[model samples]
Target: MSSEHTPPPRQQPTFLTAVAALEAVVADLDDEGFGPALGLVGGLFGSADPSEAAAAGPRLAALLPDAPPFPRAHLAMVVGACVEQGADPVACSGPVLAGLRGALTGAQRLVEGWERTGGGPLPDPEQDDPAEAHERIADPAVLDAWHAHLAVVAWWTLHLWQRAAWAVYAHPAVRTEARGSGVTAALLGLIRRYRGEQHDLKGLAHLAGMLDDEPLLVLDRPTGTGYLLRMSGLSDTFQLHTLLADVLIGGGHLPGVPQDPQVVALARTEFLDGRRVIATGAFNLVAPDGSWLWNEGTPSDIPVVDGVRTLVLDPLPYERSWSAGRFIQEIPGDLRLERVLSPAEAARLLATTAPARSAQQAFGAGQA
Candidate 1:
């Protein structure tokens, strides 16, 4: 008789299939268990597109045994090997995008459920330390693949939000509708909630130390939160408010505990409770801090309707509002930077923001 105990068949995952299987397992797990599992499993898909990751739900369910293994750098290396075998990262992105969308949606729902029932203290999965992740994930090619995959997801998240904002504001009729409605309060709520989620998701994604660019929604200046609010007050446009609300509630961006007092105060006071009106002929570049970037020779109400036309009057020479003025000056057209969101873009963006896949099946397995 053979004396040795037979080792179970090696769970040799291929690049084409690894990510999908892993994300499927992640989808099945509950909030408490998902974090740890994700650290172990997510690395398999560092360069996969969302759809492939999304599709692997069933396979992951079938493949992952209870008491799954700790993150093995070797699994990622399998992905690297496949790349060497001629797998194109860009071509593979379609499925990876689908997978990410599924993951994000599930994450968002988990947060909503927790909030609904007041789940006791939030859960944090221990991400592998950089040194550890690198040590375990020994192959440079594998690491590069992983970083590239994450970069695409992060970039898409920010780009989608920016594009969505532009789409809502570009419609004159849409802008006309919300100019004086109760939409300001609604818009405030949406912005507050989305920003809350972005705060968490962005940090989580950044923890890997792979992303090199700054977040599109910069909280420091008058542009990010301030600009959103100012426009919320000036337009009170319901379509815009609804668009933002859908992204926050439906988009799978991670949720973080909100920390900024100024942001909170402004959302509550200015957007939720402040005045809402449509400017008839006024065009002003307001800072994120709620200060006006005055055109050099014009008063705040001089009807500088054309943003680019007003650039020549920028107060950059005065250095009073250099950042805001410079931002305006950089625009190629006569339109204000804020005017970039057009209806066609909004329509295209709407399709992208649609829920890519449902979590109903994925969450069914429940903490395996």
Candidate 2:
């Protein structure tokens, strides 16, 4: 006689069960794979009619993770389902939009915490003024907070771009609608704010670098000040400079040192003739003792020197400013025809230009 065999019984899929299923898919993939998955899910759900998909929102939402390693695909699916089910995109937009907004808010809290903790690394006793200690703490803290804020804002902006691209691809009319939503203006404003924040962060980093006894709190490596300078004066060039200006002009940070005369001369020249130098590509300035300050570059070069402060500036046509006016206007000086960097310098500059983080990382994956 043959033994009787029984199959496993089917179980109903609860919201939690659905969420876990989506989360499992997310967990199995690396950072780079997340975007493709999200796109696939969006496409699948987006293809369906709004009424049918909206009915699936609850089930899709249930399948989503409540916290880290957010199931971006499931999120797209939920939105798609909502759209399919005839839920108003505006209404369906709430949860996903709220999540993004909340992420931004959380980033704000991190910044505030960093600010409350006195911003950068510790302060040096030699450089610290007893009278201004409190103000110094608060100022740098605020600036640091702003830096974090800018990063999150940039992340959100990129995210919106990706989502909008997907939506517009599905319904081309959305592209035209988006253009008129004042989004361009809002992005411009954010970019302006980012530039201002970058400037302040550079100054703070410089101040931190100057404190010889205290180690600087670098958000990244090198333990020195970094500058992000934009340059747009002469047409046909785009110059963006990131310089690491240390406390001791020539040498790294060291104790009880006389100011380098050459460095001082360089600074003065840069301050006085930088604009002309950037515009015309040539400049000669006399130091206090009458020594000449000279740094030459053609239009095609990146102005970076190994031993000296690095200045990166690009120049484009004057008319290009209409689209990137904020970026252009913020440039410290006009673009010149001189080459700033040699082949070696150019190689070094390229090495420093790292790719930006993908959308997945910006949304908190891999973050502690």
Candidate 3:
């Protein structure tokens, strides 16, 4: 589980099968318009040529307002598939674009509204038994709403669109836009909301970090908030660790935190032959005040301390999408950094904690 910037390749979304599952809905619906609705939208998302998608785009957009509550979630996937396939932007730049933006926007709106009623965990499942937990969950209508929304593809798409090849749509070239309508903002807005819910916001930093060019939506300028560094062009753990370690040592400008953060390493420690040894591995930044920053989005927290927030940006697969700018506070949760130590720190730590058994090796005077 190295937090090294090893980005898996840029795989395209599974476009064809993504919406084919929705075909099941056609059989269950009663309204006559529903069948045609499924057909029109379905064909556009099918393995049609880009020209075909372009022609069909406007028709689908016009039909949406009266389309018998067509699943916006499904529509979003279909549209994303279209983008993945290189659909002409003109078809989307019209009302079709409006529909595309609204798909993710609707999820955003839903989550934001949920935020307003209150902000805290639902009833503790551990404290309550299975039956009692169910009662507590069902008691809050908000929980019901949340579960319902999550049962669909919208939330998953929101979480995983970064893996999509067509995420290039996050930025609009002049060729892809209308006179005033926003074309690329669905992906753009997604970047901005990176600070939101844990469920909805997962994998976002990875996306922002790996982007060759993620507009730095939230972390661009200096403010009272600390900077969220871009991972653009950075390749491996070695480079990332070197840059970040230097930042910590130099008292770099992460405002609202103590100056001169300490770099702590989580070396892979093990007992060997009645002696302790540590394999060179994870590293992190720690302030005197226990403020920590490691950008590794592991399921576990830093073993060192609580409330350690990390904003690691992994370099992109290639120069392409934009990296979002962010303040440390704007990042969603307490995350970890690349589980790596800089060479200098690693050497110092090994010397201090687990020096070689022989003096010659320790002093670098051993036989070649």
Candidate 4:
């Protein structure tokens, strides 16, 4: 067909019409309607006709006024469309961004104010304490709403980052603007937060191991520690594996392994002293039965040492354990010491560590 004669795709529904359609779909919980709504929104903004989009902008802005916004999947489709049309995503949503920032600031201030008033302790179901009843009168629902709002906000922010990264990866203009405006740092921050909250090591590993760019790794080290015990160097392989283990262990998703002799041997030498065993570098252990124990936790059934702090196997990998709330809430109160590796140091080590040789290379060198 001749280019001029070929019919153009059907024009997208008007912006207000699309928003109404979306609200209807959500009200009916119509999964099928969602796709069409998204496509329509994308088409409206993504189209070459700026006048059409300009006319729709105010209506769309009015419909999306919340902070840490919602219906992010739909918003992302719209943003993607704007990006495709060679329009600035920020410019298209300038009013919405201002509203969002204001909403977020207000929400944060409310949370801070609540926290300042000592927002009362979590209920002690065991005691049914009289004080707990008094605390409940202070509108616990407000706290719940605040937390839910924050979670939604966090999710939308991540969606924005993901869309931005997708745009940068595909659009040269996006790449230029992103690089100029410190969008990379924002993207990384979102990725880090997502990884921490969602236990998504694979996603993080993919981003961290991107071949096109040097990954940013932050390191923290303890002073007055023995030099030999301090961690150094960065290895992508190690970092990826460490993060994988952390996510798995923290989520309680590790698989069981049969007892092996090599595990016993390593346990004897590496963990014999009963001091918290920390992995200074990544290493594979072979059980006596010739089975591999690539990533495993310390024996869980063993009784914790009395008066001993944490027994951190790799502090950097489990830095989340060091958070004040985590330490107070998750760790046993009696544990004498907290064993946490510096996540910063671990990340640094991972960045600097030499690439591991392939199995073939090791065998060829007679070092397997």
Q: RMSD per prediction, one decimal?
A: 21.6, 22.0, 19.7, 19.0
Candidate 2 residue lDDT tens string, 1-368: 89987988987554334434455655674456555544455555535555445555544444333422334434644554465455444434334433433433433443454466567633332454423433332345346544444333323233432342232122223222333554323333333233222112221111111111111111111222232322322111222111112222223431223333333223322333333222122112112122222222112122224433233222211212111111212113231122223445455554453333333443353243
Candidate 4 per-residue lDDT, tens place, 203-313, comes to 322332222221212112222111111111111233223333333332343332222322222222222333332323222322212222233211111122222111122
The TM-score that candidate 3 achieves is 0.33
For candidate 1, what is the lDDT?
0.30
**Candidate 3 residue lDDT tens string, 1-368:** 76768788986433233233234344455356465556555664555667655454444444444433335434544555565556544454344444434445645554454345454543221353334322333326455644433322233344333322233233334223421344344545555663345344433333233222211111111221223333332322333343343443234433222212211111111112233222222233222222232333221221212233233222222222112112121222211223244445434333322211333332253233
For model 4, what is the C-alpha lDDT against the true structure? Answer: 0.35
lDDT accuracy of residue 171 in candidate 4:
33
What is the full ranking by TM-score, best candidate first? 3, 4, 2, 1
- In order, what lDDT does every prediction score? 0.30, 0.33, 0.36, 0.35
Q: In candidate 2, what residue range of length 10 has the lowest lDDT sum? A: 211-220
- Per-residue error for 161 in candidate 4, Å, reads 5.7
Q: Residue 153 error for model 1, in Å?
A: 17
Give the Å error, residue 365, model 3. 45
Give per-residue CA lDDT, model 1, range 228-265, as digits (tens).
11222211111212222223222322122222333222
